[model samples]
Target: MKIVQISDTHLTAAGGPTEEGFRLLVRHLDEDVRPDLVVHSGDIQVLDPDDTADRVRSRELLDLISTPLLVVPGNHDVGMPGLNAWAGITVTDARVAAHVAVFGPDHWRHETDEAVLIGIDSELLGSGLQREADQWRWIEDTVADLPVRKPVLLFLHKPLWSATDEPVDHQVDVGPVARDRLLGLLERIDLRSVGCGHLHRYRQVRRDRAIEVWAPATAFLAAGEDSLPDGRQELGYVEYTVEGGEVTAQFRLVPGMPQITTDDVPSIAQAIEAMTALR
Candidate 1:
């Protein structure tokens, strides 16, 4: 089984083309590999409630994919305009439902040639949130004893923790306790790999227990200066090729594109600084 993952395309209504870079990658998949699934790991909306037309445009891109997907929302998709007013208007479930309407259900064990996929949405994992107890029950059931013929793989938008300094934009932030509860349950299952997004850059860490992660970003290679490519920012996706007890992962940039290698990435960052003249 082969799968492609794309994430964090902070798109807007103004530059409403096909998200040229995104289309390029999709085209390559359509013409060559043709993956069975393409899971988009959130941040689909551009963080504005008034951008209804743009949101609809974003969904248009979803319609172009021939493969099935498991999409979840990110903080940006939750309408980060006015914190107080956000509660009255934004419905994360409705946004997620739209994704499911295009992809698959909220969560499931998607039987693939290589593994059984377990999906969870951390966007709603908040304090004192027992209202979602039923959803948690469904996840526990889906991950229950499997056929033993497939290894288990988990997917989520925000990762369990941050391995770096960036707080607000990276890591799961306030989702630690909630995510731990979910992970503890998976510890009993026969798991192999876990994949995640939302950092906009790639970094992998192993828990020294049953699971290891493969973190890769599908968009935003914007490593201008601040985050050097060599040691800073890398924007790409992980191509997972699974075949009978063997899973190969590769962090390859979009075909024919030059990623922010150290010098270039830092230079780009410097350019941004120069534009702002904030020195």
Candidate 2:
């Protein structure tokens, strides 16, 4: 299954470079790869609106998505809790409703002749505590029922844990409660791999028998000078090919756009080859 993962688009009602990158991404999906499915991890919008809350503003644009986009919301996409009210935008379960109206919902399971992909929403805005608890139970139950021998690709916005040991723009906010619950679930399931996007930079960590892969931000990146020549998050996507219980991938940055994929940018084929060795 050639499933693509794109994250952190930061699309605003007033689109700019970020929006351009999004269009580039959409074009790549519809033309280049024609992935089996496209999953957007989070932060699709910058969330600045005149009347409604930032989350709503972002969803308004999401409604215009040209492809089958599955998504979740990011902290920025929702705007800081209190800030929304002051901005005349309200943050509530309506956000999830709005998201579903545009990009589909919190979770989905798809199986083809190739692989089985299961997704979860990390964005818990409306009905916070209750929603999280419900989703947590569902995630565990869903994993528990999966066939271990078969490969299962799990998708979520925030990572299960830290992306790396280094300090970066990302943080492990899953908390002990969320972390423990998921780890416990993993202990019993044969999770082929997990893909996430909250952290802007690409980082991979392997714990237990599973690989946790963080998809890089689709929007502008933070500097990666000494360690990164691109110095920008650089827009990109994660493409996965799954067969049986084994998975191989290339976390490819869209290669053509000079503004996004530059000379330093890793080619799609190269990126997948790079991560193949990692797996």
Candidate 3:
């Protein structure tokens, strides 16, 4: 099976370079990289979780891809959990429901003859909401029942850990407590890879028996003050080839898409300013 992972699109209804980049990606997928499936890791919207138009537009645009697609919610899509959520837009049931209305379930499982693919809502990890607990239970049950020999590919918005061996930064990675809980549940499966977005960079690391792949943002690049450590801050996506219970991943970029920065777009800059000003 061939799967493509695209992340942190940050698209808007108003349309801009970011949307153009996504269109380029669609063209590439249709004309060049014809993968079996495409998984969008997150940040499907420009910024606001309450903007119905943004969500609708994002769904409409994503439908352009010819391959089967699965999407996981990002902080920008359903808001982050905990007190330090960006712009104080914490995750709520309403926000999650809104996302589900447009993007299907926040968590899903796709199984093929060769592998099992799972996507969970990273935004719900530490929220302490009832839905969070529900998702946890669902995840445990789903993974627990998987065939032990089937290679598992997990996808989410935030990464399980950071680039360095430092304390868990909730902003960049999953919360420590939730991470432990999730890690424990995943131990039963033949985990092959964990793919994520949110960092706006492309990186891959080996952890125990699994590979962690951070897919780069298709919308813009993170540079200078906004950059994260140890990852290539490029604009692209990831393609994975799964065969005989083994997975091989490669980073890919569309030829005609422009590599843009946050500063190059006023809306993105303003959104960042608003998020930072709250701190």
**For this target, which candidate reaches the highest lDDT against the unseen true structure?**
3
lDDT of each: 0.57, 0.61, 0.90
Candidate 3 per-residue C-alpha lDDT over 21-117 given as tens digits, one digit per residue, 9 for 90 to 100 = 9999999999998999999999999989999999999999999999999999999999999988878889999999999989999999999988999
Better of 2 and 3 by lDDT: 3
Q: Give per-model TM-scores.
A: 0.74, 0.73, 0.96
The top-ranked prediction according to TM-score is: 3
**Descending-lDDT candidate ranking:** 3, 2, 1
Q: Give the true-structure RMSD of model 2.
A: 9.2
Of 1 and 3, the candidate ahead on TM-score is: 3
Per residue, candidate 1 scores C-alpha lDDT tens digits across 32-65 of: 7688887776666544434566577677776667
* Ten contiguous residues with the weakest lDDT in model 1: 79-88
Off by over 4 Å in 3: 164-170, 225-227
Tell me the spans in candidate 2 whose CA falls farther than 4 Å from its real position.
48-67, 79-94, 125-128, 164-171, 223-233, 258-279
lDDT of 2 by residue, 1-279 (tens): 677888877665555566667777777677778876777777676533222444555566555555566676554443222222323333356565565555566667666565667776655522254555677677767777777667677787777674345444323344445667677777665677788876666655666666777788876664443422121254577887776667766768785644443223334224325533442
